[model samples]
Target: MPAVQKSGTVLIRAVEGAQGSSRGLEGEVRYVYYNEPVVTRVEPSSGALEGGTMLSLYGRGLEEGSNLTCRFGTGDAVAGRQETSTMATCVAPPRPVKDVVWLQVSLNGGADFSGSAVEYAYEAGATVDEVRPSAGDSGVDGQTVTVIGRHFGSGQGLSCLFGTRGRVRGMPMTSTAVVCVAPRGGPGAVGVSVSNNGVDEGQTRGGFVYSGDLKGKSAFVYYEGPERGGILVSLNGGADFSGSAVEYAYEAGATVDEVRPSAGDSGVDGQTVTVIGRHFGSGQGLSCLFGTRGRVRGMPMTSTAVVCVAPRGGPGAVGVSVSNNGVEGETASGIVSVRYEYRSGMSAKSVGRSEVRTGLGSGSVYSETL
Candidate 1:
């Protein structure tokens, strides 16, 4: 019934069994659990997190592969800071914060205790209320820019605007300023982008008033050309067809009036072609098989509309239906376009056209396509 003390190696201590505090003896000596592991710094400095971000921790005594947990501020636990054998990598969950945030992880052996933590979040996902330069400004093209939004750090988080192409640029330490050359004619106010971690906020309005009509557009033509009986399309309405083989025909000979598709055009794909001739109106319709679904970059529907591009489909003959709209001399059914490349003396139209392929997928490591 003496105070616990270590003798030789036995740690004679007291034990309060089911009864009450009582004196007892136990083997082995006890010391401090483990040394403290400190977290030093983080990289990329900032992020517009969509959820998972591999946070690299740096600090003294920090070992690789250790269990960890992360929480936003001192409140809700975003994720059970999972443990790994390596101490450096921790997948951070979505936590919205507009200021410098802190993260705490348990260093397997009771190394970190209350009050010990690392700081992150320096920026927050922001909602863009308005932009200073609008979409198209002189110095905007290919220049660093500022995006004004609510919930942003005046400076952090995911601070770049992206287009159809997946490439993204990052922002400065301040959430409000992002540094990246502007893309050609961005769009008007639309969905704002932010990082799930680092910072997050409610939806913020934003847009890219980009130059040229091609900002969010993609246009390509599958063609045979007028010489081969395929329709000839003129994109900008001129004497010469822009060689747009998948001719867009609305007018008879003189170009039809313009009816440009709205910006951010999600054109119809995967169907047949619909040619609107002179007398066409709103009531006209047609049945089409756009090869497979594909997008139409821009289309202006009119009475004398000529649709040259077929839907996203394999290279083959498809059905083209004529309906109300403008039918000056609209074709009745299948407008076959046989692509022929004459080699020696033989006209290879039918023979060469038969070798086309469709979408290919695979079960494992490899896939074949022709």
Candidate 2:
């Protein structure tokens, strides 16, 4: 059956006799067609408030005519081109406010498309007000610097730059707050910038000061860097960092500053210690190494901390090191060091008696001389 031109209930009567026979039996059939257009999705869901965005609507039963109208906020789309029954294209008009607007399309100039699947968000005019802890040491692991500003809008397509070489992006809290790591840098004032969907939005003047530090912080997070991912950073105090933090995949590096349960007994198998630092990936494959005893399994608790079990080892002032599998980059690897003390205990020569206690489990027991 062909599609109906209009919509309404229709009743058809069928007569069983000749046209002149009024006494013949008769039957009736009813039919209805839903001609209202259905909108499934809108392309490029976000655009600048200044408008002039080419938007495409995908759906079914859509026809372009003199009565067809498309509205975005208070502005009406211009030059609507109907491609097919399932697709249409138009240019978005300028909007006065930054918000999520319903995309309305009418086929008969009387139908409303509000509360439909089509929605567009105005995301232009992003600005950066300030960066907390503007000054930082280069190659520091897991230092969280916050960017405060307006029109951040979900921070989905945001990115940032710290200095000539240091850059980081991640941890979006809201439209007003974003937290990122301090990338590796050299001695100088670093520029900062925020970008939304590849367009530069704001810049800060001398926002971050970097010191001359050659050591790289061992970061364990899995990030593609500014090239593929970003967080909003401003320059002048206000635009992009001078260098690319993502270029070297430096977000995986971290710097160790503190450790807990720093001292433990020798040959202990299950001593838990916390490693606090920056850029630790969430539950990433982290490991610990004490002296030359080998790798100890660890768990990344947060972006700034990790917990690991101390492995069996001799007593001495051994250094504690942490590593992760996420720091595979061309520039550097993820690794950091801190000191841990292993207390002296009984030596092997102090053993006196060996008890063959097989019934007390499948292990041997020995007594140590006093």
lDDT of each: 0.37, 0.58
TM-score of 1: 0.33
Top model number, lDDT: 2
Highest-TM-score candidate? 2
For candidate 1, what is the total of clashing residue pairs? 56
Stretch of 10 with least lDDT, candidate 2: 219-228
Q: Assess candidate 2 and give its TM-score to the true structure.
A: 0.38
Residue lDDT tens for model 2, 1-370: 4567776667766566666775534677875444667788887677778776677898887764435567775556445667888888777787787799778776645344534557888766555666664445545455456776666655555666655553455466787766667676655545565545333434443255543442354322212123323332442453434343422222335556667756767877776677777765543446666656666666665656666777877878766666554322112233445777777773343443332322222322333232
- Candidate 2 local Cα displacement, residue 280, angstroms: 22
Report the error of model 2 at residue 81, Å.
5.8
